[model samples]
Target: MKVTFPHMGNMSIVIKALLKELNIEFIPPPPITKRTLSLGVQHAPESACLPLKINIGNFLEAAEKGADTVLMAGGIGPCRFGYYNQVQREILNDLGVNLNMIVLEPPDNHIGELLKRLRTLTGSNSWWRVVKAIRFAFAKCEALDDLERAASRIRCRELQRGDVDRVYAQGCQAIDQATTPKEIVQCRDEYLTKMRSLPLDHLKRPIRIGIVGEIYTLLEPSSNGFMEKNLGRLGAEVSRSIYLSEWVNEHLLKGLLPVKGHKLTRKRAQPYLNCMVGGHGQESIGATIEYAQQGYDGVIQVGPLTCMPEIVAQSIMPNVEKDFHIPVLTIYVDEQTGEAGLMTRLEAFVDMLERRKRIQVESGLQG
Candidate 1:
């Protein structure tokens, strides 16, 4: 089976590792670009969210490169994501692209079914082999997340602009090339060392900003207009609430290995949003509260326009700001969102945070 999956940030790296270990022939979709967005927009429904359109675009591109089987994750919440695979299948069929589609539902609810699907695709009924492949994939995902978190910090303090980014790109290439667990660990360590070696302004107190929003848009740079990199360029250290490894742990592993701060996230989110309102709405509220409590200077919420869950979260953010006394910025992006406009707003937000910090310090001195 020649399989393909949509790109969600560095998730492709994890997926590639899994497919390779399973001995599955696969076609990796090209990175999302203007051409991909254009193709997706041309065919998708006018009101579909940005992620769905981009996914359709990715599938179309993969189909062109002879991918006959598609693998997509499924959700079981109030989010519309559970239906994406079905919708995309119909869309591709209408476009005269015949392909096999498999949706891997949350393991909590469909582990047996998921495994059956995997066995079908890989033609391997060996449960042990499948388990080994999954463990390897999860390990790589953790390594990628660690590297990304380190890069975010290094980006803010790097004395030489673009040095961290250059090394990061090279590190990603190294991780992608490495095929075994030991190789992945070595690649991660080598990249971490290089990132640490970069000259940094140790005395500089950079503003820290927490990013929270829909999982897809928040994680995928192309979908969200590369907001994290833009924040770092504007002198803010960015921390995101969602990561592929975290999602796998929470949903697929069913919390067998508890994520640090998972309990605190639910606790902080209790006052404003006590329940999951679908998607990552509850997590966004919880993360913003945690960031505020941790003394972050600001928080930014990003999602596609008209996304129901983020819209729900956005409505509650003003109260969070009032209670926490931390600034919050909400950005809704669609296909037409301009990078220039995004950069301008980010600059304004960072400036506001900087000024607030100065005022607080001055008041402290006066007291």
Candidate 2:
């Protein structure tokens, strides 16, 4: 089966590693572009959330590259994501695109069914071989995430505007090229060292910003208008609420393994939102509170337009801002969102944060 999957930051790297070890033939989708967005917008329902549309775009583009099967993840919450696979499949069918979608559901729900899906996807590969492939891919994911977190912090302080991004890309390339776990670690460490060694302007004191929102939007730069890089370029250090491996550990591995993902995040969100309203609603609330406690200058909540969970979280953010005394920016994106307009909002947010910091300093309060 020639399979393809949606893009979510560095997730494609993990998938490529997994498929390679399984001896599967696959067609990787082209990097997302304006044409991808246009194709999705042209076909998707007018009110569909941004992620589902972009996913359609990814699959359609991959189909053009001769992908006959689509590999997608499944969700279990009230989030509309739980239905994405079915909806996307129907849409493709209506368009007469002859691709089959295989969804890998969360291990916590219907473990037997999940195993069946995995068995089909892996074909006749031994269970042990499958396990090793997954373990190695997870290692790569962790290493990539470490590099990404470091890059976010260092990028804002780099003497050169794009040095951190360039080095981070090189680091990802190195990790992607490595076949073994040991090599993955080596590449990660080597690039991390290179990232640290990059010259920094000590005078540049970056504003610290926490990003929390829908997972797809938060993880996919193209979908969110490259918010992290833009924030870094505007002299802000960025930390996201979720990463792929962390999400897998907390969400997928919890039932199979002794994992308590987002335990503390859930606790912190107890005051404003005690339950999972869907998507990352509770997590977003919790993360915002955590960022405030950590003295972050601001928090940005990004999601697709009409997303229920984020809309719930966004409604409560003004109160969060009042209580925590940290600025919060809520950005909802759709196909219509323009990079220039998004950049303007980011610029204003940064300016407000800098002003707030100066005011605190003048008032003899800790900044």
Candidate 3:
């Protein structure tokens, strides 16, 4: 079966590597293009999240390319992602695609049972073979993660104020075509080297911002008006929390791994959440706390226009803001998102943080 997976920023490259290392024949949908957006916008309901639309476009493109099966991740709780596979699957069926769509649910959902069904796709039978797959997957993740971290630095120059998209495009294309872990490592090094060679140290740091939220809006530039990229242009070092490895670690072992007989983040974040609040709750709180502890100027909660898990986080964020004193901004992105609106809000937020810092410094001197 020729397998394909949906887009999730740079994660697609690593996932594509995982399938290849398994010796599974697979094809990736092309990069996000106006055509992809047009196809998605034409067929999807008007009110769906922008991410869902872009992905439908990705899947439809893959289907048109003769991919017989598509691989996707499943979700839980009140998140609409929990039902995305079902809806998108039916949409493709209505279009006469007759495609075999695979939704790999979280490990707690018994991923092994699903893996058994697709074992032939991996071309591995020995227990050691599965172990090997795990090792290779980790290597791919590490390489891809490092590469994106570097690209994140350069994207500031490329998409922000400087015009280096040609080089950025070269790096992104390198990632898209990377077939081996070693190749990924090379791409990562090249991206970092290119970024460091630029003339960027003259700009002052704006309010340092950390963005965390639903997977789709976080990754899709069109959905958020490239908010993080815009933040970089505003002279902030944008830190986003979502990557292929983090997702794999979350699904595979982070929750199950014991730290003094319980999950570390859950145990550590208890003062924050007494129980499982569900769907990235532990992460959102933990990352904010970490950023606050690390002295980040601010944190921005990004989510889909109607995302529930983020709404849950939003409910408790006041305490985080009160307790940590970190200026927190929430941006709910949708199709109607205007570039001008986002720019204004971000500028205002950054200005507030700068003023707050000055007030604190002046008060300290007076005391």
Candidate 4:
């Protein structure tokens, strides 16, 4: 069986590596480009979330290439995502696409069943092979996460203005060119080292705000124009919530795979998340509260216009901001969103943070 899954930033790299370890044949759908977006726009309903549309397009393209089966992860909750598997199944059936979509359902509390579902995908029962795949997948996840985090720092303060983007592009190319486990690790470190050499703006006790919102606009630099990078460039330390590896190990293997990241495992953030919240945006609300209590300077929530969960969060956010004394900024994105408008809000937000910090310093001095 040839299995496939949708892209969630760099998670595909880890997923592809895991499939290779399991001796499963698979395809990596092309990167999200205009052509991919056009295909989705043509077939998907107008109201469907952006990721849902892109995923449908990805499945259709793969099926046309003679893929017999689709491998997907499933969700559970009031979030629209919980039903995505069922809906996609029906949609593919009506389209007369003869294929089997094997979904690894959410494991709120059941790893055995989840393992069984994964076994169906791999067509193997060997414990050793399972062990190898899990180890390799986790290793790859960590490597991808390291690269992403380093890239964020590099983008924030590229000392050599002109070389900043070039170095970053080369780093991504190096990452994508990697083929083996050792190669992946080496490339991640090499690129990170190269980028760290560049100078960044003086951090200067900048306000650190964690960015949490819809995953697409959060992770995809193209979708959100490197919003974190922009924020850091504007002098705020940006802490992003979603990393490709984090999502895969955290969201994909809550029950099985043995808690990939040891550090984050102690917190058990999934319950408030309620199954990765898919595109629901409820996770942002929880993250806001959590980050505030941890003393974050502020929280920025990015969502596309008309996003339901974010709109819901917006209604309750005033209470969060007032009670916690953490500033909140909600930046909405769409096709029409432009750089100028985003900069205006970002500059204003930074100004507000600076002014408040000044007042605090003055108040402290008075006391």
Best by lDDT: 2
Clashes of each: 0, 0, 0, 2
Residue pairs with backbone atoms closer than 3 Å in model 3 (clashes): none
Predictions in order: lDDT: 0.88, 0.89, 0.71, 0.71
Q: In model 3, which regions exceed 4 Å deviation?
A: 45-48, 109-114, 123-134, 151-160, 163-169, 175-180, 202-206, 252-269, 362-367
Residue 241 in model 3: lDDT:
62
- lDDT per residue for candidate 4 within 62-166, as digits (tens), equals 777777788777776555666666777888888898779888776777666677878777675486788677777777677766766666545555555545557
Candidate 1: regions farther than 4 A off = 108-110, 261-263
Runs in model 2 with CA error above 4 Å?
Answer: 108-113, 255-260, 365-367
Worst 10 residues of 2 by lDDT: 251-260
Score candidate 1 by lDDT: 0.88
**For residues 1-367, could you state the per-residue lDDT of candidate 1 as single tens digits?**
7999999999998999888988898999999999899999999998989999999999999999999999898878888887988888899999999888987777656567567767777684478888888889888888888889988876889888898888888888889888889999999999999999889887889999999998899889999888888889889999998888888777766665555535578678889988878888888899999899999999999989888989999999999999999888999999999989999999999999999999998999999
TM-score, one value per model: 0.97, 0.96, 0.84, 0.81
Sum up the clashes in candidate 4.
Answer: 2
**Error at 323, model 3, angstroms:** 1.7
Evaluated at residue 229, the lDDT of candidate 1 is: 84
What does the lDDT come to for candidate 3?
0.71
Model 3 Cα lDDT, one tens digit per residue, 1-367: 8988888766676677677667778889997877887888877878777777888898899888978888887766656777888888988889888778777667555647546645645664565676566556666666656655554555544433554444555776676577666776787678667766666553544456777777677766656777866777666667776655666666654433221222454455568776665566666666777778778889888887766667777888889889988878988886567778889999888778778878877899999
Model 2, span 108-204: residue lDDT tens: 5555666678887999999889878888888898899999999988788988889999999999999999999999999999999999999987687
Q: Provide the lDDT at 120 for model 1.
A: 70
